[model samples]
Target: MRRGRRKFDDDEADFVKRGRIEPALSEDPDLPETGDRWSTWDNALHGPDPLPEWVRTEHGAVDTELGMLKTGKEADVYLVRRAVPDTDKVSLLAAKRYRDGDHRLFHRDAGYLEGRRVRRSREMRAMTNRTAFGKELIAGQWAAAEFDALSRLWRVGQEGGTISVPYPVQLIGTELMLEFIGDHKTGEAAPRLAAVRTDREGLEDLWRQMTEALSVLARTQIAHGDLSPYNTLVHEGRLVIIDMPQIVDLIANPQGAEFMARDVRNVANWFTARGLRVDQDELIERLSYEAGLL
Candidate 1:
């Protein structure tokens, strides 16, 4: 559970401090004296407004990294706590920092980049050639895409209740801060759908939720290009989708239908294997129609 004041051991404190971006001066004049770094809200691109009250937007707010929550090929999510010193105001954010071109592997990027475009022909050529600059651009694109996708989906889900996504908090270069979907008090993340175990009734309910989420995405003309049980989380019996950096524009991408179908099959097969009667073909057809493909 969250304490009024959390203390970090020597090792933990050192780890957190090492991750901080220091200022030019020995003792940075710009940063607050207490936390690791000042609130980045003043410099970064912000999330959709009517912002949540929990978000610490004030300049007095500072961010401190608690620990890493997840690691992946493209990015690593760290548990970041943003708070106003001497105040009770605090927000827990999952800060997903994308690896730079030199460090990141681009094996899964080609297909997803088909429909996405950059204005400059030079940039496009560089991305196509996988130049050093191009890889950096691609990395930034992934972060921006996911942030934009989550922002749009969060608003839509709030209106319709068919799907759920973390509220995007902010994006700075390749670092995206999102609403941490877990026990805020304990800083423990919810289990992925792949790790969830449930009774028959619960399984059926989750399946229904999954279908509704897919339907909403189809109607919105987007495909979660890499959706799977591993990328989906269940919190308090609610299904929340995550990891959409490769989200496909259903009408724009040439293989959009294939991607959507593949997504459906991936989850449907899992459900069927667990003794659920999933009509994959039927679901696919319905989604295709909803996406205006039929």
Candidate 2:
């Protein structure tokens, strides 16, 4: 359950200083050692405590790739099983690795990067110019942004008992390892809200949950920016929000209201078409007022 960045031991530090460090064992395509690679828990950033009981934090743990679960324009999520060798302790994680360099698509990154900033002018210029290096930096920022947003919201959801998000297990560079939200035994992911066919009662319950989640974001002065039924999942009748790299600051971004309104309208229209009564304008007004955008 420990939190914060982990430091390397003296022996490992000296080995690194001696220039004896080589590629990580897991990086070998031959499936070096046991799993594809050693547990990244040693040096990568840790998640908030108290950590889940299934989180495998031991250094002896190895990560075995189960397969890819989902792929998107910016990132691809893989189902990985981290388990200690010769032990039953195991954790299934959704490893979301952001694409970098020429392979990454930045078609929608500009607007989302509006309120965010970099520390250096050179880096800022690169990002603005859409240079190769800049694209890489932007990719890293997206991953970090999602991790930070998820961490904050996860805590809020934990305390509020209304919203739900996958636990952010760890973040390393542009790779974010999240607690898998699905059936661990069968490795079957929860169905996206868009794919779910529910009864009227179920639709009402989902709409209620969605509104509450949006209200929470508005009160916190943030917006999902690209929310839709496709980015949400329904697990056991509970709604879970995901894909938040484009989370917008309701106060900082000038287009925040526009983004927030669009978010409300997108899902509101979905519910309304399903025979549910959702006043999009009313919800937008309420959320805008809550976000101090009114």
Candidate 3:
């Protein structure tokens, strides 16, 4: 019996094992066609331009289960998704569609756009003239400026390790696709810090994060002109900055320092109301010094 051990051929063993394994299917039955389900919303009320056919085609396949997360006068944020190829995966993304013809609010302020290189005085005159073509060009530039500032922030913050930004994917006209900073599976919108109450310890952390964000802005030569609780997101004990269409360039704008001071003051005062002690002037000086702007 000890001498009766038998050797199995590799091909025969593989054949026997293959019978137990199921053959691969041609297509995934569980998978659905891209953009099969369509959901519609009122663009006027939502601030998103009507989703273009190509955008829908490229990004509409994932469970875009449309939900209005936040609506402002300028734009609205929609929670969306796009399916990843070759894997049964869906990623949460934010679709911010700026309202068309709504550039009046930001574009009307010539001071904000000052010092930036304009192609021509004629173009600037056209923008100032408010002609149909001029208005459209201004709107396009405004949108492009937001996209540019956001891209800079995303890159600089990540590189400096001072903050985190959702990965920016594309900017199609007034529609911007960004990585959603919330948990979509649970269907919970990321709570803006302004909308939530925090304890003393949490408030201190928030204050620190805000100051750190300011330092990052200064380091990158940009100022978040509209920094406030509403634009700050509290996710997993971290603060994420958003809504930067009004971000200002420090080098180009003479009022950049004032804007930076105001930003610091605004965040500091908000935390002060919550029982956190912060000195606006000191914070501003520190930030300016750290940024080498002082």
Candidate 4:
């Protein structure tokens, strides 16, 4: 299961000279240093087209898969260090790879596919029937949809909006590379909102931030349809919304209004249980108005 660490017999160096690994482990010589020869960068370390401008500036850094960051039913995220061949310009990227093989684990995604166009008739049939090929297709769509959503929200967030998201780097097939939300040097993921219990003022501050994020979504004609304390992250005292492959269309989906109300109610209940009284009804009304749905 370990990737970057080579099991040496005290002959070659046990670790790479200038590579990073998770849990601060030594390197593996069997793994390719530049990563294209391996699966770390999803074999996009060097491609037919040039790398993106932001990453090309690093002069084509090497990606080394450290280890698994997290695993879910649909995908598995890895901790990978992207660094120059022999220099110190390095960044840790989260490589989220959706399942692409016949071993499907996640399902029941039809609810979010309401407005998503299924271009190919056969593909649509297969997906509806839940065939092996259908599962693979759905996996790819999920990754693509999430990447698009993140890109859109991140762009608006850059304009000083309240929403915040992990910076999306690139997407290759089912593999998506994103900016590491936590400390790259340590590979520590930020705590999810469900894991945080703070003092009264701290709780109030978080609620305000959460509301700001919700308003941002409302103004953008989007709703985090699966929003829950579990999907939200608290990093450096800021709210970062994630897992939007199922993001609802505030204007397109037939159940858009219901999804919007449910989103607000789910979060409101969490805060209410934590002793924060909220005008949940009024907040939902204001947000729906902000989203131009009223």
Structure candidate 3, residue pairs in collision? none
Off by over 4 Å in 2: 1-32
TM-score of 3: 0.75
Off by over 4 Å in 3: 1-65, 84-87, 102-108
Q: Kindly list the per-residue Cα lDDT of model 4 for residues 59-164, writing each as its tens digit.
A: 3556667766665556667777777776766777777777764644555577777777688999998888878888777888888888888888887787776888
Task: Estimate the lDDT of model 4.
Answer: 0.72
Per-prediction TM-score to the true structure, in the order listed: 0.90, 0.89, 0.75, 0.80
Query: lDDT order of candidates, best first?
Result: 1, 2, 4, 3
The predicted structure with the larger lDDT, 1 or 2, is: 1
Worst 10 residues of 3 by lDDT: 10-19
Cα displacement (angstroms), candidate 2, residue 198, comes to: 1.2
lDDT of 3 by residue, 83-139 (tens): 544555556667666665634334434666666667788887877777777766656
Q: Write the per-residue lDDT of candidate 2 for residues 15-125, one digit (tens) a residue.
A: 102211222223745453777788888788888888889999997888887776665677767788899988999888988888887876547778888899989999999
Which candidate, 2 or 4, has the higher lDDT?
2
TM-score of 1: 0.90
TM-score order, best first, reads 1, 2, 4, 3
- Identify the runs in model 4 with alpha carbons over 4 angstroms from their true place: 1-31, 34-59
C-alpha local distance difference test of each model:
0.85, 0.82, 0.64, 0.72
lDDT of 1 by residue, 1-294 (tens): 776643322112121222333222123467677766787888889999889899899978888877777666687778888999999999999888888998874467888998999999999999999999999999999999999999999999988999999999999999899999988998888788877889899999999999999999999999999888878889999999999999999999999999999999989987888889999999999999999999
Model 1, CA-based lDDT: 0.85
Model 3 lDDT on a 0 to 1 scale: 0.64
